[model samples]
Target: MENELTLKRFVDIRRNLGYTQVEFAKVLDIRNTTADIERGRTKLSGKVVAELLKQFKINPLWLFGESEMQYLEPSKTSVIPKVVTVDSSDNENMVLVNAKAAAGYPQNIQDTSWYKQLPAFDLPLPEFRNATYRGFQVEGDSMLPNLKPGEWVLAKAVEDIAHVSPNKIYVIVLEDAVLVKKIEKAPNSNNVTLISLNDSYPPYRIEPQQIQEIWQVNSKITFGVDATTEKGLLRQLQESMEELKNQFNHGKS
Candidate 1:
């Protein structure tokens, strides 16, 4: 029989704890074989599962798919806040919207079609629970290490413009485009500066009236490699390519 504690579930559980495969493997004191285990190509050695439960307070039943709850109880040393799906009574809803949601968000914010069609899930972060939240498929690397293309950012709706904080990430609505960028309060002006985390992309200033809606990005679900790591690799590759190009040009000269 296929193991209920499949590799996919293991990766999902690690992501829930905000740890990467390498980091989680380090915590478990496993030697350099976490990728295989996370890929389900291998299983834990004897006593490894017991050590994992002891170190991370993981619920064995939950890990093995025998239970729905994630953790047996709070770990005394755990500084991370525990999260669970919203109970059945509250109807906590979060719909994952497509990249086009940015362009159509203002129009479809009240519509049920997109909300119903997209994949939705619930989270229990108290600071964000009060607001209407949705997942937006982001694109472009302008935000760099903060937000990346093909990732879904969980954004909470901001009905009032005054509530936006300076230098915080926001999903801003425009007539033709929807963008995720940092907001910088301008000096004695009605406009706010939209900034990108990647320095290559320059900052832009726009009038608040141009903004149709605003949403605060609270969390993100990423696929493939982490953005920070990917960016570093890209930067290295770019530098190498430039050097190689320069050498070729010098040789030709």
Candidate 2:
């Protein structure tokens, strides 16, 4: 009976919120077919159940038919959690401003302008918590099995650079571009080194004074959607290689 309730209510709740099976699967990070779940053909794993509760705030009791709605209304004894939702389209319009780059990096490419606006959607935004904002496009396979290429991450902003700790990921805005790296302070200088989660890419150091600003990524609010497919991977690779060759030629000239 409890299992039945979990299956039935899970489908009902997601549909009520206007999410298609594919959209809901993406949100849950599940790589399964939605039809399997909806038709009760597949059993929900504890991990999947946990993800549903965490991502959507679905009530377990309610999902199991011990309660009324998919979510409980806040009451004297019930604690209401905050949720932040971000839409991809709104972020697409955000503006990127100018900043300095490293020396001998090419003057013409150093000072360029671009704009990106993030898509708008409603998610939980907790009040009284500090938020950091930085932009980065996923690059390598280190964070793979989680983040993929061409996916964008919007991180929360942190006020104190000195407060950064080890093993935590951060979205850093340097003089030239925004990056996602694990931050560690340099022993001798006021600079911090950005280490890639993937070991393949070597870490790079940048002076604290050189950075215009830094933003802590909001993992809960930060989500990635597919922008490229396997079929396009080769074309993307060719274009990237060509661009690198051009840059190399320009530097030698």
Evaluated at residue 83, the lDDT of candidate 1 is: 19
**Model 2 ranges off by over 4 Å:** 1-123, 127-137, 140-142, 220-253
Worst 10 residues of 2 by lDDT: 75-84
Query: Which portions of model 1 show Cα errors greater than 4 Å?
Result: 1-90, 100-103, 124-128, 224-253
Report the number of the highest-lDDT candidate: 1
Q: Which candidate is the best by TM-score?
A: 1
RMSD of 1: 20.0
lDDT of 2 by residue, 173-236 (tens): 5545556678899766566788876677788877675554455544412222322443343244
Q: Note the Cα lDDT for every prediction shown.
A: 0.64, 0.52
Candidate 1 per-residue lDDT over residues 124-196, each given as its tens digit? 3344466676567788999888777877677777755656787578877665577889887766766778988
